[model samples]
Target: MNFEHSDKVKELIAKLEAFMDAHIYPVERDYYDFVHDHSNLWKEWPKMEALKDKAKAEGLWNLFLPHEYGEFSPGLTNLEYAPLAEIMGRVPWSSQVFNCSAPDTGNMEVLARYGTPEQQKRWLRPLLNGEIRSAYVMTEPQVASSDATNLELTILPDGDDYVLNGRKWWISNARHPRCDLFLVMGKTLPNNPRHSQHSTIIVPRDTPGVKIVRSQTIFGSLNSPGGESELRFENVRVPKANMILGEGRGFEIAQGRLGPGRIHHCMRSIGQAQRALEVMSRRADNRVAFGKKLSDQSSIRQDVARSFCEIEMARLLTLKAADQMDRYGNKVAKDLIAAIKVVAPQMAQTVADRGIQIHGGMGVSDDTPIAYFLTLNRYLRLADGPDEVHMSQLGKQKIREYNAMKARPAESRP
Candidate 1:
């Protein structure tokens, strides 16, 4: 229960914050200007590689990978990585600068955990080096993707290759200029048990029959560079070696991957909310309304207090989830993972909304990150799984858990 960070984690946090203040915070607006320009669609910011090189040289690279990968990982646990993630989360695009962005982080974990040595040599090496990016193609336009068993994409065996055919949407990183591959999930064994029917296979983005239909927008912005996209796989094929953990193992890899990823997202959401709260407080203190500062108003004071309390609550919950995952395992910590997944995003969204109100007109504009924070947190509710889905599963688990306790002798329960 002790959430005190180890000496190593504290040192890393100090270094990370110093890096962000010196580099990321200074250029935040310039980075946004480059990405938001219509002419810069799908183009990397000119300075991204240099920033990444600096981060790597400073030993800040691959901070998201918790498991030991020899020299690839810094040998930190999930609990240790939480504060670092919160630091990166303050800037949405800054994670990639340190090779800690999502889709890639989750993909790297899969390769490290499940990919063959050859697969690791080809894909994982480049990803860890930050030479390329990747996409996790799972959701679909035709089915309710939240229920992954309802996935309609097909991956059928054909001699030495697996042929894939279907449509996928809301895929992050598909439009990245350096995106090299996709870890696609689809039905590979239809007649198997419900949970065992799906398989994950690596598909090179340049593979034949792979087509990007169009980039999807978040609130009218392209979310440029790493655009969410809809992709079509018409007889796309890859070698059998690309199959990860063999048939009927997609769900297994997914379960393992998502536990850490969910906590990471929550950690980042806390950062975003924290930033919003600070921005709101500053605006309230400085802005005058009706001949008085907004900070002097009782309503504004209440909002500031509530946001501060909620951010702390979410941050602690995320740390507890990270601690549970590190000490126990993803399965043992599933309930807490689900709880934080539902709570953190909603908390961030609420805090951001309040910040937006406090900022008045400036909040809705790109002048600050508050608007994007609201959007990101809102979509996160549907990303890993919907709020209702987690609540339902958690409810069932709690009911079963309490019922088992009830069936035990009263003395034994105590």
Candidate 2:
């Protein structure tokens, strides 16, 4: 199979890499400093705003949306977008500068695919323009959310409006000052079949009874501009027009939304792992331990070598999933997506762990980004679907294949 990226994609990659070096990488410290110095920690960083404006002006905005958006689209196939995603991912916060951050990207896809015309005019337009941010409220504290159908949130019809009552955690981007919307998933018909009972609705953040209970920290550090949040919806109300693609379609929308979202995470994790490897290699070559540089030691060399191999494998698998999504559609690529979701985070964690080990004590410190990278990658292992969940799904698919083959005619099977 042809694996080479198109010329257009290559050109964009060069531009994006240069943008990261010239703008993002240089301001990483300033961005953090701005956040730390500001009292409104949940507010957007001014430096980030400047950088985003510059990136948008340079035509680097919204690179994640596929061709379906028409004039504003990235026009790149999933394979073509892989390298660009990797570049954007090298720095954890850099994705938002180009308006390609998650939760928002996934939410935008839902709006583009399922939102009514009125819904698009109000939410999708601003989202595409990056005028405001949004959040996906799906996971609940009381449920094993990996099985999404187990969600217990309720959206009951109240005359011409729907009243929402639920508690959701890990609601990313909801804490941002500019976050004006929420795509909430809950059950509208609890007694119906598990999957068919749920629906996703658009709930404006300012709606009465919608409260941001608290911001959740990741390993004690609060991610700025938006971190995970705990939210409470006590009779939160929205108009009937707010339901996306009608009632009982939450699972369908979620499947479509997560297909691209999960793969994007995998693509970005490769970049994170690659960056970690780069740092590890540099540290190993320069740092002396027991009378020799770490690079000269057998253990360090083996780790670097194995990390390189693993990162490459994960990248290839991620690209394959993306390509499959592009060619065969997201549903058809489910197995590949599940495989990469399981593989990429573990690959990233291994690379990050090696980097930490190579850096000795400094790896665990904020003195280097390795610690943050490690934490971020670790969260990914559980974020989309835990490794165990994906593994089980993959195993089930394999068993189904084997059973189908066994039932086939003898000649055909042979």
Candidate maximizing lDDT: 1
Give the alpha carbon lDDT tens digit for every residue of 117-217 in model 1: 99999999999999999999999999999899999899999999999999999999999999999999999999999999999999999999999999998
What shift in Å separates residue 227 of candidate 1 from its native position after superposition? 0.5
TM-score of every candidate: 0.97, 0.96
Q: After superposition, how far is residue 253 of candidate 1 from its true place, in Å?
A: 1.3
Estimate the TM-score for candidate 2: 0.96
Q: What are the clashing pairs of model 2?
A: none
Candidate 2 least-lDDT 10 residues: 405-414
Report the lDDT tens digits of candidate 2 across residue range 209-319. Answer: 998899898888778778899999999989999999989999999999999999999888899999989988998899887899989999999999999999999999999
Off by over 4 Å in 1: 68-71, 407-414
Candidates' RMSD to native: 2.4, 2.3
